[model samples]
Target: MGPRPEYPRPALRRAEWQSLNGEWEFGAGDEPVFDRRIVVPFCPESELSGIGRRAGDVVWYRRWFDAPEAERLHLHFGAVDYRATVWVNDVEVARHEGGHSPFTADVTAAARTAENVLVVRAEDPLSDKTIPRGKQHWTETPEGIFYTATTGVWQSVWLEPLPALHVTRLSLVPDLRAGAVDFEVDPGTDFVVTLDGEVVGRSSGQPRGRLRLERVEPWHPDSPRLYGLEARLGQDRVETYFGLRTVEARDGRFWLNGEPFIQRLVL
Candidate 1:
C-alpha cells in the first residue's frame, strides 16, 4: 500500500493525485502499546514498521499540503482497518467501516492555510466476522507464516487536488495494426496528450467550453505506445498517461500485440 505506482484506480483521475505517504506520529493512548516509531502504510505488526508487535492501537497521523485555491482538496486512503474515523484540522470529515475496499473524503471546507492535523482513530475487535480478513491472522499465533493482529493505518494515506472544471478520466484502446491508440476523454475545456512534458496530440474545444477528443493514434503492442495527457480546464491542469493496446481472443486463445498467444498459469 506504499504509494502504489498504479493510479486512476477504479478510474478517478491520476494527474489530480497527491501522495501523502511517509512518517506519521502515532499515539497509543490508554492502549496496550508495544514498541516505538512506525512507518506509514505498513501495519504496526509488520516487520517493515521497524516495530513489529501486536500493537492494535489507535494512531494519529498529521501532515500539511498546499492546495490550489481553485482546486477541490480531496483525501484518499488505499484501505484502512476494521473501522476508521478521519478528522481534518480537528474536524470530523469521514468515518468508514469494512476492511476490504478503499474510501475517500473531501476536506476542502475544513482546510486552512496553517497546519492541518489528520487524526485517524481505528479499532479492531479481534474476532471481526463481517470484514474480509484476507491473509491477516487475528489470533495470537506469533510466527510460522501467520501474523499478529494489525490495527490502524494499514494502508496508504494521500491527498489529491482537482481542477474546478477538469478532465476526470480518459480511456484508450490500442489497434496493433494501426500502431496507435483510440481515446475517449471527458475534458471540460481542452486536453493535450504529451510525453515527458512534450505535447504529442491535442483535442480542440467548442466555443462554450466543451472539449471532445476526435483524432487520435491507434496503439500497437510492438511499439507499446502511450500518450501523456495534459488537459487544461480553467486554472487546473490534469496529467495522466494511457497505454495503446488491446486484449482479444483468437482461435479459442488470447492475443496480445495482434499475435497468437498462450497464457501462463504456474502456481
Candidate 2:
C-alpha cells in the first residue's frame, strides 16, 4: 500500500503537476549505473516494484526533479513497456513504442533550467511474435498458468506545465437521444460545460459544438450517474467526468437504449 498517488490522468487534466513516483534508479542497461530502488507505477514484476525480479532486455531509470519555469514542459507516461527512451538533462527528449497507451515528451527544452535529470530507457521484448506482449508469460521457468513478464514503469509518471496555447485534446460525445453532449476540441477555443455546478453546456469558439442537456440523466448500472465537466480553452482548464449511457446491438438481442438488455447471471 504505497505508490498510487492518484492524478494519473483524469481524462486529460492539467494545472501544473509533478509526480515522478518514488525512488527510481535501476540498472541493467546501455549505460546503467544507479544500482537499485524501484517503485514507480509498479511493474518490475509487481510486488509493488520493490525489485520483484525479471527485468533485463535493457532497463534503466533514473530520477531527479525540480524545474518549473514553464512555457511548455510536459513529460507524461502512464504506460511504458515495449520501448521507451527519454532523457532530459542529457537531452534526447522522448521516444515511445506502446505497452498499453499514454505517452508524452516535450520536456520543454530539457526541463526549464535548475535541476532536472530524468532518464529512462526501457526495451522489453520478451517476444510475443513481433511484440504486443500482453498476456505476458515468456517462459524461463513457469509452465501451466502463464503470466509473469512485465517490466519498466507500468504506469503513472508525470509533469505538466503548459502555456503556449494549452488544452491539447478532449473529444466527448454523448447523445442520449439527442440530449446532446458533443465536443471536439484540440485548439478550438471557447468552451464551457457544467452540470453539478449549473451552466449545462455552452460553446462558442466552436471546433465542433453541441452541449444541450436539460434533465437527461442516463448512465445505467444501478444509477451510476455522473456529469460534472468543466473545460476551458486558452490557458487550459479541464476537469472531465461524464456518463450518458448508450449501448447497442440490434435484433439478435443485446441493447441498452433501444430496450432489451439483460445480464446479471450471477452477480
Top TM-score model: 1
Best candidate (score: lDDT)? 2
lDDT of 2: 0.79
Candidate 1 stretches greater than 4 Å from native: 1-19, 28-36, 57-71, 98-100, 140-150, 161-187, 194-201, 205-223, 248-253, 262-267
Instruction: List model 2 lDDT by residue over 1-267, tens digit each.
Output: 347778888876666687888878788767777788888988787777887778677788888888676788788898988888888888888888878888898878767576688989888867546877656777644556667878778898988888878778888889888978888887777766666677777777777778788768788887887777666766678777778878988888888867788886872
- Show where candidate 2 strays beyond 4 Å: 1-58, 61-70, 81-87, 90-118, 121-142, 153-165, 168-173, 182-202, 205-210, 213-245, 248-253, 256-267
Clashes of each: 7, 0
lDDT of 1 by residue, 16-58 (tens): 5656666666656544233355677777677776557666445
Tell me the deviation in Å of residue 107 in model 2.
4.3
Candidate 1 has a TM-score of: 0.68
In model 2, the Cα lDDT at residue 246 comes to: 83
lDDT at residue 169 of model 2 (Cα atoms): 83
lDDT of each: 0.64, 0.79
TM-score of each: 0.68, 0.37
